[model samples]
Target: MYRTSWSCQSRFVIHRTLVAYRTKGMPVPRPRLMLAVILFAQFVIPLSISGTAVALPEIASTLGASPTPLQWVVNGFNVAFAVCTIVWGVCSDRIGYTRSFQIGIVIAALGGVLSTFATNIALLDTGRVIAGIGSAAVLTGAAPILSHLFHGADRAKAFALFGTINGLGLAAGPALSGLLMSAWGWRGIFAAHTIVLLLALVGSMRLPLLGRANTSLRQILDFSALKAPKFLTMTLVPMAGAIGFVTFLTYLPSALGAIHSLAAGATGALMLIMTIPVLIAPVLVHRVLERTRITPTGIVAASFACLILGGVGVLMLLRPDLPVALGVAPMILLGLGFGLPLGIVDAEALAAVPAERAGAASGVINLFRIGSEAVFVALFAVILATVVTTALPGRSGQLVASGEHGHPWIYHDGLLAAGITMIGIVIVLGIVFFALTRAVSRTPALGEQLGEQ
Candidate 1:
């Protein structure tokens, strides 16, 4: 009896010691409410970007900015968003997710207010660029911020929520832009963004910090955490995915306009059609696919295939009769291609490094994607400009002073550019995905046999 009691006591002590060791920096095990708020903030960053895109014409006319420089309004935010992600990621690890995120909200508010008073295009872009910086700060901190709030199954759920919210924000931006634009015009949009920033700031402050006391800049970021191979793939695959996506979204709007003569509501409807699949994928992934043991590489390879099919599908829309709705068919596949990679890549990216450094990993990935976004956005714009400048004016354009003469040929400059570029991405993604897929597996045989399926 004595021996058994002592042994039991010893085991109890050992178990408690292990638990203590596990909880070192983890203050509270999980905070679901905080995760919810963090995801809501995630909703705002892309909200601003997509919202602004829908309101571009209004912004240009209100500011007296011409069509060419107007692209900067959109570019400015993205540029800052892309550039600041890495910096904020490192900062979050050093400081604390809550504090870093608050700082971001404050910075974004300042940018919003400043943008309202700009007299010229440069000033406006400057304000947007400033806002972009803040936007980057917020996004960079979001994933890392939530790491402590979840782990294991909860962590997967948190990521799914974050991704779904993000997809919704992007999909909703256009419609929200239209609503805000119709009601308040250009300045109203800025005012709304400022309001959003302030609200997020206030809401962010209320989030209980899961017992975190770390408030150092180092909490926001750290450089040493980025040596992992999975982290590298996380960064590159997403960028490649972003390039594929940016290629389509870049030209898709115009393609619809030319092919279907889709009006504003119709365009939003088409985007809705594409985004629906994205939202569904996350849920299905959580409920169904998570049950199976699946490799991230296999999923990404599937995504690459989706990109290829989506690109080809869009090119097919160039046909006179789309049979189905405009962009409905192609967008279905495109969203599959775009959504799966984004879902898997980002989730894995966060899981790749230490929870402490997930933000930094996110930032590294953002750097690659942002760089790609800039290049592709510019490339897409050039395509549009080429088509617009060279095409002959329509009868409707004769009525409007601002309307440009669009290309006369079927799939003229911009459309053709989009088609070729998308196909190029399809090929590049195929090679890179296949090569990378093989590298990660034990044997090349495990990787999907190219041309086998």
Candidate 2:
């Protein structure tokens, strides 16, 4: 009887073990490995975005493309990234985050293959677009995977790493691209990019699954958050920066080449003055928030002031009379202006709405943020090209816009026109931002607002 009882208990324990294993789904990678993979993937997306700017001159020279088509090399990526980010966000919910992220890596690697071998400008831009779409999936899938993998303090740390990795990529992109371009020419940059993506893809294969999809949470795009005036105003801050700063960031290498006749290596080194602040300013802003009582609104106001000055300061480059060193100060100012309110505004915007709508609010704000970048950057390029056409007309104007060696005087009118146009937009945005911030009461911390939920 004692032997029979022991056998029954052993069978019962084994049965429970099997049931628990099935309930938890398939075994996955250890959490630490997953974190590393997610962070690695995050780093490359922004690297690809900002690094490609350094390659534009080479692409132009190699393909002999005109200005308008050349602009698409950058714009095609931005527009595709902006649109696909939303699609990937929704798809992650249905197909599981791990799968979505793996698919993204595969697609991006394929795109890099195309980019590495392309002989024509059109083929190159198409590769960039495919890469952009894949980048969106990686970004959208990261947060969900991290959220599921960690809890409380660990979760916060994981996200902090996420943000830091993004900033690092943006900071390091141009310099790395320049190094590769110098060593093996432009195709080397894309080849290195492809290699990195393939490594990420291999790592992703080990990621633990997040179980079956949660189809019950399906909801369409929600814009109910836009009704709040304060939220709307806060959203405009980044949009303003997108117009005032990102456009300049993307095209500055070309501008430098045009004005100072610098080579690709030198231009990339110079861009560090602008991008390094973007990497560090968020940390500075966080410290200031903790140590002082300065309001988010005040911080934003200061950001606006910096952007306006930075815009005007960049116009100094258009003058043949000013020293090139003067450009450094404005570049730092623009970087600070964009970086000061980086993560703060997103939290503040979400805090403005009801707790339940926080997710929707985030989606709305991101869409606007990306859409503004796509629209304004395209506009900036078009305005610059149009002005150049009017001044020089036909092929000479096209060549100058494409960053071929040209007299500094030829770029003066085009740069001046584009600079002034951006400044005017920033000023108008500032006026609206200030008015709306005053209309609302001081915002509470996001943690405080969302505590009940």
* C-alpha TM-score for every candidate: 0.73, 0.83
TM-score of candidate 1 versus the correct structure, residues matched by position = 0.73
> RMSD, each candidate, Å?
8.4, 7.2
Clash counts for all predictions = 16, 0
Please report how far candidate 1 places residue 358 from its true position, in Å. 6.0
lDDT of 2 by residue, 322-363 (tens): 777888899889888888887687767756665444444555
lDDT, residue 10, model 1? 32
Q: Can you write out model 1's per-residue Cα lDDT over 149-190, one digit (the tens) per residue?
A: 444444555665665566567655655655565576667778
After superposition, candidate 2 runs with Cα above 4 Å error = 1-27, 147-161, 211-222, 350-364, 442-453
Q: Candidate 2: lDDT over CA atoms?
A: 0.73
Scored by Cα lDDT, where does model 1 land? 0.59
> Which is the leading candidate under TM-score?
2
